[model samples]
Target: MSVKKALISVSDKTGLIPFARRLVAAGVQIISTGGTASLLKAEGVPVIGISEVTGFPEILDGRVKTLHPNIHSGLLAVRDSEAHVQQLKDLGIETIDLVVVNLYPFKETIAKPDVTYEDAIENIDIGGPTMLRSAAKNHAFVSVVVDAADYEKVAEEIEANGDTTLETRRKLAAKVFRHTAAYDALISRYLSEQVGELLPESYTVTYEKAQDLRYGENPHQRAAFYREPLSDQLSIGNASQLQGKELSYNNINDADAALAIVREFAEPAVVAIKHSNPCGVGIGADIRSAYQKAYEADPVSIFGGIVAANRPIDRDTALAMKEIFLEIIIAPDFTEEALAVLAEKKNLRLLRISALNEPAKKVDNLFRVAPVAGGALIQDFDYKQLEENEIQVVTDRKPSEEEMAQLKFAWKVVKHVKSNAILLAKDNMTIGVGAGQMNRVGAAKIAIEQAGALASGAVMASDAFFPMGDTVEAAAKAGITAIIQPGGSIRDQESIDACNRAGIAMIFTGTRHFKH
Candidate 1:
């Protein structure tokens, strides 16, 4: 078989030079456009400019570069069928066997706080996807590669089998479609947010595989990590494991819970999370004291729970943490000595993430995906956050100063617990949490039970609405003096009446914090 023709274009020049060199060694004729063409030429690769291939100069602000018939016909031509081959020959169009491309950096361009509209518009690519789709549409006879990581595999295949097989071409085409769809989603979401719309009718998103895990939620299932095409800010993708075994799915979830709960505290503190609920939490003079007190709050739960510190990890704090069997520890910074102390564990995941205590700000990437019966459900992640000042007194009796402190602590704890969440707190320590319950009353009872004697002076907080006063009656029975919740249930008045009659102080923030 003759050497195949390959089209190459990308905004990210990473790995392009070596990839193009290998392709050249395989005797593939490389064609590229714009900066990619110039870049390849500078690297001494035999690359033809798209304008030259099409016999048309790039026009319309470079928008009309690759939209011509020469490029599309070349990529879409069928190489196997005699009739299609003769038709392509009659049209004098070369059959393209491979296409490799990455889209324009639109999201990165607009991420700058002071990015101009002209800059954003200029960064948008017009012809890259057109060529990618054309190549993918003819996958039966053409291979489409969207990511540079696949370059090595493609090169190896051509070196061994003389060309990528039909199966490889089809798989590459699948990646092409996914790449284009994700690219479009990012563009749509950006434009919608720029115009202040909630959800658009159409969407596009782009993510590349980060790594393939040993297994998924279970050892038997398969799992892989994919991150957004853009930068990861405060996400699990960027977390650093200072020491630890390979993270299980449950470990990641619990670590996320630990981090999420600590985000609720404006003041520097330490929170220990186990099974997605705060088993221990405290405000302290410093992180070391806070962690110590939090550990003392529930030593049993501290055995393997994740710990999140709002302050930096110092030598003293790290040494203190070393005495525990924590799965993960997160803080803004870690001292050299602190990291050294942590390094001794050899299996503890240590993450240093800044900007953890920032006020709730809306994120553009909030689309959620969940599998349904026939398809999947996609919606924006709820951005509601309960500010300390926004809470309102609903009951006739107002909470005393002592009760207010515990109420605030419980409120913060409840936000991090899964729904139907019920958190009981005394001062800064979380005494009990009934998370993932079926009903509000049940949640209250579970938390009260966990609190035991500690429930006497503690305050209670709920993540969502209270259907009736049964929860209030339950709290009163458990000796809960103050309660804070999002009041939007069908029987809100009944709950309020029960709170008033039972002499239990209650307040509503009108904001629910349901993790599930």
Candidate 2:
């Protein structure tokens, strides 16, 4: 399987000349089209234009090039088959021993702000994918290279053996399919958007590996981080780590939870998260006060937890944070003095994400996917927010103005917590939180116990309707004066009766936020 002729048509020209020169040095004829042919010719490499082989000039605004029968027959011909060889000889078509192609930057083009529909349509490469697929299909005889990163290995293999090995060709062919699949997915997603179809009959998504994490949630598991292309939203995946060790899977998960909770507050706020659950959250006049309140809310649980702030972290907040051991600290920005102080702690992971200051916007069209044993569960993202008008008073005693504000804050915090979640808040700070319990009563009890003396006048928020009156009775015993829940349980009346008996005010949000 010696190399004779190679086709090179690429949009990404990285290492093009060097790779082309290597091929030419090995006595292989180089056939190229458009910019690739011009660049190789300028580099003093002997090149044959695609039109010379196809006997047809590029037409339809350069869309019809490399799609001729001559190119396809050369790439699809089997060397061992006499009939395949005779067909190529009869047509006077040279066999293409290799194909090097990369698709147009369709994802990059659409990512740009204000890109027009016609602009995106024009950038879709027609002949490149066709040639790559043709070469890949006949991988036993022809090798396909879609990634520029494989140039060195490919060149060395050809230089050493006069051709790529079957193994390498097979691997390259697989890569070609994956590359084309992702390209097609991006095109499909874009077209669906154009047609105002948020959820199409079929959904496709592609992600590029970002990094290999140290490990998964447990040390025994392996994991890698990946991200969607052209995502500009505020997220842990897109954040810049300014200092400290690389993030582990748990660190990323906890940091994501912290950021999600902190973003719920528009004012200066801080959220402390442990094991993907918010242990404490606070909103204050400034960042320092917010940090202080959040830390004090659950001092024991905040140890080694991740902290996220909606505002720039100042020196006083840094001083308070330094007093405890923390896994990660994330914020929009940090003051010079604050960074200097926190720099003393060598292992603390610090991240800077300016998008934190911006309001969190819902990505309506994207689906939240969770992998199962044999398949995946896909559904729309929960972007439901609590509106003032959505609140309904269900108890005889109405919530005071102060109680109403704290109830709203508690409701927002509880949404990010795991199922069976309960949050107790006072003065715009979460004094206690219970998450991921097997039963709602157990979660309520845990939150009440954590609040201690703070539970006396605090408002409680439940992620879902109370199943029975036991949770209300537990709240009453802890001295919680106001409660907010979705109020859709079959035993809702029993819980309402319990609230009335305890002289507590209750409100229904009419919407349940059961996060799992």
Candidate 3:
């Protein structure tokens, strides 16, 4: 059960020298290959080259090293089995008590700018994973270490017990498999993306844990946060939490919705979210004006909501925000004065995302995944934007220039709302929003009622077309002057006729935005 010989081959040489010295002090012979052997010799640690043990030279640009039975047999031979020991003796193979290895930086190589296909392929480690798996499979006797963080504890255990305990070996083996599986999955995903194969017969993805949350959507449910590696896109995953307590499940969800809605505007904008749906949204020439307009949109709902701003928040904006009991405030940046003012609310979560100032770009992994009772559902992200050329004037009267601008703003806000959705807007702010209703008319009625007198001249936006004219009638009754929707229902003419009867202008976007 004592470690007499250990093989070390690692690309990440962190803490390698000290660990190697510790093994040498314990009378454990170190066998190494390539740069690892060179570094050990330079550090004055007694080492034996891999060629000395295998009696074969490394070939094919060092790709053929450690693929021989001389190496794997030493790792795989069962120490307690009489036949295994006899085979090792017959083949003149020594027992390898431990393996220390880490794979090539394939993920880092592919992440580089202008990296070639050959570069990525060359970075894939064949021998490293093979050795780790071989040692891991025989974990009852051989210990395998993949993570540098485990080196100190492993060295301590070996110094005290003369060998790593069976429990430690088993845990290390499980970690090795997880690490190799994630590595293989990354390689597979990169190759699949190159061939434009998004959905393959087998699918696998991996995420690194960011933090453990206190609870999930409810207090009883446990949860954790995981982030995608090398994700450069501006998202909630990449935001830096500068202040406030840890984010809860609902806080992250609502903040993500607020950020997404605010990003829809090129101008200075603010969006307030409640329960993962946009309660208020506004665009203005400056951050202060924008926040004011967003607050005026729905003062009651904005009380405990999440607020996201596209522009840097200033003193005035922070002063205004301090009046509310907001759960979180996210923006590109916050002025020193603004931070000092907002710091008064110790529990308010503050997040800064510099990418918010940059123009939006296409992300590599653009998919929305939702978990169901049994399996899951995956679909393309709704990156669709309304274009000028895609608009079709279906009503008799055309929208005025002012009405058209409000219609566009309303359309953008409606896309982020839950369906069936109805949103009313005036100027550049949402006045009322009704989302997640069972029927279209019911949603419209709720929006109209919320808007009240504000609905008289406001424009309405629907995520999808109206199945019946009742929605249009409801809007007309509320004095809504303009409407925007994707017109493709069997009773489209009924809605159009209702719009004409009320002299309301309407436009069909030829596309729908349905959020579930």
Q: Which predicted model would earn the best lDDT?
A: 3
lDDT of 3 by residue, 1-516 (tens): 899999999999999999999988888999999999999999999999999989999999999889989999999998999999999999899999999999999999999989999999999999999999999999999999999999998899889989999999999999999999989989998999999888778777888888899999999999998887767658778999889999888988888788778888888999999998888898898999999999999999999999999999999999999998999999999999999999999999999998686645545566667879987787777778888999999999999999999999999889999999999999899999999999988999988888889999999999999998999999999999999999999999999999999999999999999998
**TM-score of decoy 1:** 0.89
What is the TM-score of each predicted model, taking all chains together? 0.89, 0.97, 0.97
CA deviation > 4 Å runs, candidate 1: 17-26, 159-161, 202-206, 357-359, 364-368, 376-390, 394-396, 488-503
Per-residue alpha-carbon lDDT of model 2 for 15-84, expressed as tens digits?
A: 8899999999998999999989999888899999999999999887788899899999999988999998
When sorted by lDDT, best at the front, the candidate numbers are 3, 2, 1
**What does each candidate score in C-alpha RMSD?**
3.0, 1.4, 1.4
Comparing 1 and 2 on lDDT, the stronger one: 2
Two-way lDDT contest, 2 vs 3, winner: 3
Candidate 1 lDDT over residue span 405-445, tens digit each: 78877776777788889988885787887889889889889
The weakest ten consecutive residues by lDDT in model 1 span 356-365
Error of 2 at 463 (Å): 0.5
Candidates 1 and 2 compared: the better one by TM-score is 2
